[model samples]
Target: MKAPGNVIGFPRRSFGRASAGRSEPADATDEMSDRLLAVAEHGDRAAFAVLFRHFGPRVRAYLLRAGGDAGRVDDLLQETFAAVWRKAGQYDSRRATAAAWIFAIARNRSIDAFRRERRPEFDRQDPAFQPDPQPDGEETLATRERAESVRAALAALSEEQREVLRLSFYDGESYAAIAIRLGIPVGTVKSRARLAFRRLRAVLGGRREELR
Candidate 1:
């Protein structure tokens, strides 16, 4: 039997890339998208297996880059694809490519995990403040699902755009600090962040309104 949390085995063969170290042609992503859509439409375990092999490591790497615990990454990995299994049918290829869609799932899962472990700060000055109400399971999940659309917006960003945003928001770096670390000027860091935020708002703003 497969491991308890895993839906498929790790594939020994590398996918999409050729043996000569050349990147696969453009259709490779589209092919993966079609396969994922197949799993969505027909519940194909074999197709899910292929996707797990291709994206599993990349998702884990994303969580790691966002400061997830090494020990928990495997569990997070399991949770992410489990969600993919349940929610794959909702994926819209026209709105987001398969890889981008999967990454959005991973991002939302990470956010959910963070929320579960986070403790809110307390301040004595506000008498009107009350503790956050605990959400029922269905409500909690609904919120996480909504975050997927926002993450899809993030997936549209260029790597440079995403990297700066990750450094600034995920790692909580100041603009100057990010510039220093990336060996770029502070103006460039700010520019990248501005462009990323603009794109995110442009893409996610309407989606957020729809959820409302």
Candidate 2:
């Protein structure tokens, strides 16, 4: 959904400018986090207005730098913040800083734009589209067991640790990219990833011993 003009209460033309050169202060970040929590818990329009004003131009600049068309960047920016508003309850400060969570949403919006632009028409009759051969009973059972073990190990992790693992391995994002997306230092990203891996190894290793 587009950000309502009245809701943002800012000059639309200003969105073309980049905010990256400016460094956000620690106190400002803490205040933003508190405002976000306020919006999540109370549906406070004033708090939301604060977020929209702060993030609107920044997200617009980010989308443009990420190769988004200037024409569509405004729409993407609106959608990104709209998602933040709708999904505020899902935000966990323990998992990521406010900026990181917001930028991650912006990154997804940019990726979605690219996917839409390059999407190919599906061919139902193509030989390459054939389904894979069904696995034999033993193979299927083995696969199921392995998947269950991995799921269990993952479940043992804290939410923040699982997010690092997902972004690093499942999403194939680089540590630097994850740092940018999550609004943390690269060192912090690496620490979380290292800790996550150590925990996974301990959990999975214990399961292997049990199976043996």
Candidate 3:
């Protein structure tokens, strides 16, 4: 099973390149993982199917642990595999656990699913209503403003930086996928992304002083 923190780009894949060779003990799952990654990278449907059978349960389990609604978990499970299809080339086993990468991807997919459907069903005296009045206040406004500042800072970045940031943050792309899509080295991709994040942090600066 994928461990945690995956960032799949497309649907199922023929295992692609990244972790060409890492010093790790040989095991059944690892061996299967290697094959799954290679064939999946090439868009082999059969390979993708194998991957799904092996890893899909793990992804589903992860979602369940995260408090996923049983009704929608199945749908999210399919979406996570789809992401794997488009991003097989980005799996660098050396830099990340195959399991962890898969986990992260599934987690991101679940969160994205929620965000896409997130909206309060408003109705007077609704069953979901809470007793807390004046919940929306200046504090909430300030927090939102800080988020906007971060978004603005991201917008100010170089096109490549912004793209990577969005894929990494919103789309749950790993450094490897960002490199493949951007035609840059993984190191360069990570460095650029780091710089972007740092810049955003500075732009929204405050020791809980100004922006805070």
Candidate 4:
């Protein structure tokens, strides 16, 4: 299935160049939704193909705009579509348009990728990875002190800033998702997170310096 002109036109260098000079129909959004439903209900290959052609480039563009590298963008595009295929039954046209549903999947895939990159790799050879050993007096006291410090830092934040930080880091929610949940703008979520982190770093850094 050929994508409509409206669906094409991501940067030429990002993925392969798309065909120029095309346009989508007025009923394109509804049409896409119907195709997704067909795939969900009947496992329709043709309908799935059409949906892919239509949304693939747009999803690629969105991922790139979200700061994904070329390699990561391609992988995320595949992951996002795979999720769409698997979750098509959950799509509700009354609640969200097909494009909205597909893009939300893409956004979540991007967030998962980012979190994976940020996570520290565990080493099998490290003693810490071995069966747990009871902590001695110094170790136990140090652990308690660190936990107390973190708790104090968190307590110092304003309610809004603390909530944003909790949703972002602890709950692993994307800024866009948090914004939707909080009924605030995405920019506000980002701003609150930034302020919260800055405050945390200042407080934690001071504590470390005193310990040294």
Candidate 5:
């Protein structure tokens, strides 16, 4: 009962076309935000506190919609403000209102969290931080072969399987967030992630040891 869309519809048989009529809280929020930014930019902690008090719940709601946890919302909220403090100068009215910018930051942080989780972990050579080196020529061949096998297995999976895996592993999103985003049941997300991981195990067998 939904229309096909190269522009919008999902590329699979499952998820229905999302409604196109949802409105943003942008305009109603911008006025308060601009003033707050101006005050906070001048190092007004009281004003900054006011802004945070007012906007904190809004930001939490926004982040939740973007796939975040209730438990971690406070942590993310703190990070969002810290970012606002550091990047106040980056706010450009020509693009977005202050609230919109803040909201966008929250959304981007959510996505960035996803992107970061997709990367291989760093090693601790200096007891601080260091990037892991990539495989060399001969080792690269074996690595590439392994990558190919993973890709092939992933390619052969149902779209549902691949998507759940991507959201969990690649996006670092939780089951609830994935369910809300995909507009499916929470149980469905959990089940699919489980099924996908199982299939991945079947595909990789002993070679999946590196992931653990």
Candidate 6:
């Protein structure tokens, strides 16, 4: 049997307890977003525990989709939540729910890690040090929410469709690139992407109408 702190090889349950001063959240019925904001506003450890318990696996999966290796995924997951702990104060619920906010942090951190890993050497003249332009707050929020909607829609896709979409869109790979990486034919890659996009557009359109 696994140990108490063990969570699918992440070993975070004990860390959550130590940081939050409570056991990990066992309740499945809890609303996590409001609880996460409560942690942000009041430094509530129990709320933190709930947030970690709920979002940890999803964040880990997000990191993997962004091309994070198995070796670094755990470290990246820890760093992602640590930033959440520190920057939760900056979270704006009017713009993003707790889940979207968490994902944005994870995505940005994963990109940073990917850039660092891909650089063979550091040079002062390296353009990597130059800051990329940031989207304005409203634009950033919209992008994050759109990403959240896409992620939700992805869960509804067939696994094959989901895998192709993740590689092409999230990892920014071309059809040929994904074919080589996945050891599949280029035509099949294009087919998968076309179908995935069609599904995503339908799903997102329905979601927009529901919001009205």
Between candidates 2 and 5, name the one with more favorable TM-score: 2
Instruction: Report the C-alpha lDDT of model 4 over 31-91, residue by residue, as the tens digit.
Output: 6666777777756666777889989999898878677799989999999999888878877
Candidate 1 TM-score, true structure as reference: 0.54
Of the candidates shown, which would achieve the greatest lDDT relative to the real structure? 1
lDDT of each: 0.71, 0.68, 0.62, 0.70, 0.62, 0.70
Residues 66-160, model 1: lDDT tens digits: 66799888899999999898888877665567787898778777777765566344443479777444434543323223445566788889999
- List residue ranges in candidate 2 displaced over 4 A: 1-27, 116-212
User: How would the candidate models be sorted by lDDT, starting from the highest?
Assistant: 1, 4, 6, 2, 3, 5
Looking at model 3, report the run of 10 residues with the lowest lDDT sum: 10-19
> Which residue ranges in model 3 land beyond 4 Å of their true spot?
1-27, 115-212
Error of 6 at 2 (Å): 32
User: Residue-wise lDDT of candidate 3 within 96-160, one digit each (tens)?
Assistant: 44555677678667766666665343443568765334332443333224434555787899997
Q: Pick the candidate with the highest TM-score.
A: 1
Which one wins by TM-score: 4 or 6? 6
The residue-level lDDT of candidate 3 at 76 comes to: 85
List clashing residue pairs in candidate 5: none
lDDT of 2 by residue, 16-114 (tens): 222321353322454566667767876656668878888788888777777767889888988898899888987766445567678778877777785
Models, CA RMSD each: 11.1, 15.5, 19.4, 18.8, 17.3, 10.7
Model 5 C-alpha lDDT per residue in residues 1-212, reported as the tens digit of each score: 22223223212211121122125333233344444455545554554555676678888877676566777766787888888776776665433455656776676666666445553434344587653344344433332244446678899889988998877765558899889999999999999988888887787654346434
The clash count of every prediction, one per candidate, is 0, 1, 28, 2, 0, 0
Residues 98-191, candidate 6, lDDT per residue (tens digit)?
A: 7767877887787778875552434334677753344355434343355467568889899999999878766767799999998999999999
Displacement of the residue 147 alpha carbon in candidate 1, Å = 21
